[model samples]
Target chain A: MSSLFNDDSLKSIAEAYEKYEKELVPEWLKKLPERMEEFNTLSWIPVKRIYTPLDIKDHDYMEKLGFPGEYPFTRGIHATMYRARLWTMRMFSGFGGPEETNQRLLFLIKHGETGLSLAFDYPTLIGIDPDDPMAEGEVGIVGVSVPTIIDMDIIFRNIDMSTVTTNMTINPPAPVLLSFYVAVAESKGVPRHKIGGTTQNDPLKEFIAQKSYVFPPEPAVKVAMDLIEWSIKNIPKWNPISISGYHIREAGSTAVQELAFTIADGIEYVRQLTARGLDVDEFAPRLSFFWDSHINFFEEIAKFRAARRMWAKIMRDWFGARKKRSLWMRFHTQTAGVSLMAQQPWINIVRTAIEALAAVLGGTQSLHTNSFDEPFRVPSEFAAKIALRTQQIIAYETGVVDTIDPCGGSYFVEWLTDEIEERAWKYIDRIERMGGMLEAVKKGFPQREIAEASYRFQQEVDAGKRVIVGVNMFVEEEEEDIRKVPLLEFNQEEIEERQKQRVKRIRSERDKARWSTALSNLKRAASRGENIMPYVLEAVKAKATIGEIMGALKEVYGVYVEPPIY
Target chain B: MSSLQSISEEIKAKRPLKVLVAKLGIDGHDRGAKVIARALKDAGFEVVYTGIRQTPEQVVMSAIQEDVDVIGISILSGAHIHHVKKLMEKLKEIGADDIPVVVGGTIPLVDIEPLKKMGVKEVFLPGSSLKTIIETVRRLAIEKREKEKLLT
Candidate 1:
């Protein structure tokens, strides 16, 4: 690498900086007193008032950041980026039963949502049928309940499975849900290879952040790999795993931690898949990521830029991946739900817009801007529409999409990107030294880190160090006194009763002999260390309920009991 | 004996105020529950937190086994009405009805009254300060102890 500045020139510049600081700073300080405060990023990275070439003096332009679409794509993965095509506005939508969720999906589609993201209810997420005793009140509460193949069919009833890409935010039971999607697509005459979307078959993050895990870590990851292996052969268009850092950030880890832990989990997944005799290039291209666009505007942008660069290095240098596509780190960004406040709900709109803009500047491939009212309940229709419009305004009106990585050459952005990447790499190194993410998780390293970060943040908020508009500073005397925000109401008892009846009907209506045979085959395959995907697909086709399939697997793999961390 | 001495004696004789912190139903979002657990622990309460996706029956059974002074249920999945109501019924069925239940999470304003009517002693919605939650739990624990003494 050619040096940007010679030794004498650099020394001259350093001397000049020292002279300026010594002479000019004192004069300026006397005339204009500086604000008496410590400045830092939301993640607590110290910030200086001004950034210059001195801050990035060590930056090797061609090595640290290359041309967009080149190796180590710090600028962006694609050369043209949004100039060629805008990022997909994939709004995450789901609530009540499949029918209701289907309507929401269509509503988003009608409002120019380019892609669909499905959020399964608690019962579905944890691999339980709606009628299960444990699933009683939770049915269709948080997300749509998909208990059987029929429910999945209803959810995607008229939507063309081949045309629209879908993303399912699910794990642990991801394979079962993916099997149902396949069954739905096949029944719709869509070819298996033509089916597209991603299932969040990331079990490691579930242990780290989201606690919707079913089996033990080893077996759960085995199941995730099973889906990845199956997707490589059959569903070429499908991304089998979306290694998620979104939930990690929501669970209160700093941006660097989210990046590192998520990448480490990706590394663990890659290791497991390669150990199963799969080629790195074959499965690597299908590996995608999910990230959170938190309120820290510049920090979030830097985090995303750093993520792409780090991922490229890991894939090419570490994993020896040769495919350029394999080296590209494609991710979906969701605005941080934890940043939304229930106090001044309307202010959340501004927060979401800023977060979404950061994601755009960060070069996300897909984005989901969270609704303002999400802190209270499921977003009302008006709120969801406004959230979608937030993205539209950024894309069409803001002109941010006109350029490719507009912030690429900014000194502050580049410096922050390097800093975040360095910190994240250190975390990755620590995890690697601990024998990787699984061991780290087993020792509750990430969990305790997240808990501590969460507690510290709460303390900051409570102590008035951090200002949350209406939460701590401008406190609302009474809810009624504030602007009336409409709440999304769902008839819980009605939804639950209808879901239970549907499950019961499906149980009675399906060919019991076929269901039993398929379930037995699944249980046998799960027990004998065979690939469980084919059997799971067969069971789904046989109309086996999610709980039944998960129950059989649970009998084999056993449930995970998380070690108490906090 | 002096009142302070008698109070200290009572506190020494009694077990620490045990609070069962639980997430009932399928909501895997337990950041609130976990935060509350840590805060209560810091405030000198022994908190037994059941991890996410716990059924109401499981929560009630655990509460009974732990013999908790308070049952703090955190539900962000928007099923608080159904879940908390069923939990209240389950506690009644098990005859552990004396335990005061405090609910927290993103509860709707309209549902707050109904949740309280379902025997939830307090409802802490989103943006509820940690100090507020801690103070509420402490006050509720004392009220429960006094009521138990009267019943005895």
Candidate 2:
């Protein structure tokens, strides 16, 4: 491959850079010494004062960064990008009972939200009914509680499942949740092929970051892959797994660790499918991703750009995926929740705005700008609208989306993009040598790495090496008391009681013989190493609660116990 | 030496304060719990972490078996009200309520006073400095140790 610039041109640029650094830098430093003793990114990647073409002189425009929507998609996956259609504004929302969450979904759609992302409460997330002793006070505390087909039907009662794409943020028992959704859609006259959405079925990341694994590693992954295989053959439009880095970053890994570990997880999923003698291109097109757009402006943009380029190469070279769609890395980005500060709570709006802009510039297919009041409680109605408006202002007023890949050729961005990609590849290779993400996670490699990074970042903040505005720097006096903020509060007991009653009603009214047969069939299929999606759907349609299905599977797969580690 | 080091040495003069750091209920967000656990351990205290998804019964049992001076519950699930109530009841049932308990995470300020009234020693919200957490834990540990001596 030939270089983008001729040698003579590159040599002259290098000469000019050297002359300016040698002569001008010394003069400038004498007048105004650098503020910090050392300059580094949040991930501790040492950044130079300035970048020049000489920094990326080895780059070839064609090989490194082709036009948008092409192989090695360094720019973006869509040629027209946001100029043709704006990114989806999907605010991940859920609270109270299924009816309440359904109301919120309608409200967001009325306010111009392009997509839906549902957050399940702790019990539903872990595949337990509200009445479970383990679920006492946690029924609908953090998110919406949906433990059966009845709740699922109520949650999507009015919404058109065929038009608006929904993303369910659940793992481990993802197949069960998907079954509930599919059964609900089918009841509404929506065919399987027409029901388009995504289930965050990536279980590998659960063991690494989210800590929400149900079954042991081997069977946990087997169940997740069952969803992917079933979805590919049954529901063509559905995205089975969103290989996610958002939870990884929230659990406190650096941007590079998020990139490397997430892609490695994606590779493992692809391998699982192919090991079953399935074609890579058959399912690769539907493999999507989720990322955390953090506060670091340039680094977050570069991370997104690098992620697309890296996945394209991996799919083509390693997996031999021939189709362009199979190689494309489509992802939804959420502004970092961990970055929001409790002090000067209103300033969180500005933080989220800045982070949302970075996601747009990074070329995300969908975005979720967090509410300013997230640090205090679940977002009030006022806060959710503000978050939605932030995305609107960026799309309509900012004019950042007029052109595609706005930061494509900036010297700093390109260099950082390459730097992040190279470092991420090293981590991926190391995990591959350890026999992929499952083995590495079993040995607690990524978990330990994240713990170390989180501690180091915390130390930096505590020591004042890092500035978090109201927290460490600027030292706000008499910060606003968070209680005064109009926060959303839930009647936990009432919600739990209502949900448990619904579960009981559904179980008692349904045909007992069908429910029993459905559950037994599910357990038999799971035990026999067969795909359990059809059985789960049958159970869900037969009015079996999530807890019953998971219980039946538990007898076969067993529960995962996390080893103690700091 | 720094004041933190001096405090660590002072605490070590008698014995390393055993602290049991735990995550109660089904919440999987353990970043805050792990960070606080490591910080306490680094401050010359012994920290026994009960991984994630432990019920109140398991935590109380661990505290009594470990014989820790302080029990720090890190929760972000908004289920703090339920978990803390159960935890306090369990500790009282076992007559181990003397161990100082500190709660931390994305706790609403409105809930702090209620939590404190339920026998919590301190409520550490976000933006709480490690200095404050460490010093408070040490003071609580000293109080618990004194009570133990009196009882014996």
List the global CA lDDT of all models: 0.90, 0.92
What value does the lDDT take at residue A463 in candidate 2?
A: 96
* iRMS per model in Å: 1.7, 1.0
Poorly placed runs, candidate 2 (over 4 Å):
B1-11
lDDT by residue for model 1 (A1-566), tens:
84455677778888888888888888999999877578787778998877767788887888988889998899899999999989999988899999999999988898899999998888899999888888877888788999899999999977999899999999988988999999999999999889999999999999999989999999999999999999989999999999999999999999989999999999999999999999999999999999999998999999999999999999999999999999999999999999988787888999999999999999999999999888777788899999999999999998999988899878899899999999999999999999999999988889988888888889888888888989899887876622488877778789989999999999999999999999999999999999999999999999999999999999999999876556
Q: Using DockQ, give the best candidate's number.
A: 2
TM-score of chain B of 2: 0.91
- Candidate 1 CAPRI category: medium
DockQ values per model: 0.61, 0.79
Cα lDDT for residue B60, candidate 1: 93
DockQ of 1: 0.61
Clashes found in each candidate (C-alpha, N, C closer than 3 A): 0, 0
Docking class of 2: medium
